[model samples]
Target: MNPEKALVWFRRDLRDHDHAALSAALSNAGQVYCAFVFDTDILDALPSRQDRRVHFIRESLAELDTALRARGGGLIVRLGRAGEVIPGLARELGVASVYANRDYEPAAKTRDIAVAESLRAQGIAFHTRKDQAIFDGDEVLTQAGKPFSVFTPYKNAWLKRLTATDTAEWQCQGAFAPGPAEGIPPLEQIGFMPTDLDTIGIQPGMSGARALWDAFRAGRLARYAALRDYPAIKGVSYLSVHLRFGTISIRELARAALADESHAWLNELIWRDFYFMILDHFPRVVGHAFKPEYDAIRWAERPDWLAAWQQGRTGYPLVDAAMRQLNYSGWMHNRLRMVVASFLTKDLGLDWRLGERYFADQLNDFDLSANNGGWQWASSSGCDAQPYFRIFNPITQSEKFDPDGKFIRRYVPELAAVPNKYIHAPWLMGRLEQEAIGVVIGRDYPGPIVDHTQAREETLARYAVVKKTG
Candidate 1:
């Protein structure tokens, strides 16, 4: 007997091409339908209405609907809880099964389970495919049959295990006529406001990801190794937001990396997979430290310090500039993310969770695993984290990566008049020099909020609780 119909539920994977569940549904079922849930269970929890991520997702969904229409199918969009919505949609469409790409985040996984159980009760088979990561949690285990804590070994094993078949793209083409043609809801209809995404020159959808990939391939791929660390340069691929939303396929990216010999960039992709594995194997890392002993170390109750960091008035040029960039564009350079995270946890003596939660709210491309892993890595509280003593000196980092202060000047324009020599540390400028520049250190731009030298010593003392474990 031939399969009657199937539903492809879009989650993080938003595009039409190279989709696992969509391809499977098309191959198995006589008719296939596509749908997306606004998922108020998640959306209502957002702290702001002007969220860039929400705007990006909405735009991408519109594009997806258009793309599907061209293929004789269209998206079915609903705004409700997925557990209730998916089953209802499946029943309405009379689908034999519901297929979807897997989402690995703790909350997403729980939701998927609930949806699966609901579909099972209705006698509708619910199937999930591996589309997000090249390797799943169990794909790259160690010699001792345990998940890896360190990245280097995991990456080595991942590379050794990789084959051409693993990187091959899943071709999802042809017309799927049975799909519904409902139009996407506007931002206002969904209770979200327009954000600065467009003003910041961010393009949404698959076309945007393709354009970015083409630009990166033509201009930056060759010199990515040399230029990626410098924030002032357009060195890194700007496809991060696209990757987060699955506007582009991970397999396509990995394939392009291999074809272009972009080893450094490929390593970064592997790092992403590593973090996913960590999140899957150690779920508690979401709220607590990976190394439990590190949790014993005390964090300061300094709301003023956190507020200064958040508002970009910490008085350190690099850290302040990074925060300002995040505040303005909803994105930050990776190198600067680490520097600013270090300043927050080590210099300001605040908990890493504070920085993590702040980033969760601010970043347009925020992935729970990557954001949490980055914060714990910066705070020296996660597996394979930098040593506690190896704190980042914000001033030196500024002078080195952004020696000409080009990045600093762009984000923290108050320091534009200061000479290159004093741009990284304007507080060092003599009163006459500050006056000559038509900017006063304390009046125009605030002085250093906390002395780095003093903070470094205090951070070391505070981390003494984990000294034996070190």
Candidate 2:
């Protein structure tokens, strides 16, 4: 006899603990089949064959399969378009229904719709749950029953309505009893080559996420507010990578933050939801601006500047260091992400979309909504975005954030010999002083790409077309 089958289709949310679809599948059917599809719709557009994210995803899935197999279950991995494959797999397994967590991207939403329709045509029910974010579509709203264009009001309402009921942990493996089996495709079989991070031991699974979460709760949660700006302090929760893969549950993290006294950490989580909510309401922001009038402003394509930015040769210590980190590691510190994004748009006078695409390409934690929202915010084109005139001063930013020049020194080793006073702006130091440090601007270190003074003037003029100020 065929087991009373249900298939849980894993997308972003990868963990067995606090997984809604996995739990629902366990309860609704006698036996559950778990699967993940490396959707080609997303993968085909990626320029990098050596994508660290693809490797990260495969590693996470490998761990997921092991955990599932330990509990009389297994994860079946497939590489194809999910819309084409999920329904086919469902029919093959003879499942009554398919369950999955909701994804908010416009393309993803369209793909899921197609998948759902395909399953429905075959008499297989497709069920989806809001797993990645705290507030799903229409869950948090104003008194006016309109989607929020601003964040603070939305965040307040989101907090006001919150209870233990709002952030409940999902319990997997309640009562399902099925035969344990090893599952999932081999790493190379999935067409993703291994990443350097795999060897560096960045910790890529459920256990790693739990370890980070536990450590964050015990030691770093209190200092998060003060030290998150300083990348050298190790104050920020390294959970962005985990959160990107859904190796950890958003509800569990939210619950922990909510229970804790610090509102700072909760604010970061709120930013995640805020971006997710923005994406759901305004999918137009993905390729364009949330505020459309900014579209009128002509942005320079400036591929040369873009190439320099990507290569970390921007000739600004802070900006160059941040880019080097991103180029080398698939991660960029959140604070530096904001700083570099602002520099690209408001300093170099380059298009925000270029920087957005760069972040999308390089960031391991790159979620479309968050990355888009961030770039647009820096460019003053997002909903409730910053004003155009408020450009980041890279030198001041470096001096303030990396006060002792620790972050810059780590990535810009050429500037290692420079005195503390001149580290942030080596070009400002005298040639004799530079010689003493065995450093020469335009030789050992490149000169500033665009003088901040000239760049600031150019940025202001460029944004004059889109300025909203009265």
lDDT of all predictions: 0.92, 0.86
Q: Tens-digit lDDT track for model 2 on 1-470?
A: 33578999998988888888888888788778888899887888887777888887888888888877778777777788889999998998888999999999998999899989999999999999888988889989889998888889988998997888768887776444342354566557766666797564578889889999999999988788998999767898889989988999888888877777668999888888889999988888988888888887777778888888888888999999999998888788988998999999988888898889888888888889889989999999998888888889999999999988999999989888888898899899998988887898998999988899998898888877776532
Worst 10 residues of 2 by lDDT: 174-183
Model 1's TM-score against the true structure: 0.98
Clashes in model 1: which pairs? none
Best-performing candidate as measured by TM-score: 1
Can you list the residue pairs that collide in candidate 2?
A: none
Regions of candidate 2 where Cα sits further than 4 Å from its true position: 1-3, 174-182, 468-470
TM for candidate 2 is 0.96
Whole-structure CA lDDT of model 1: 0.92
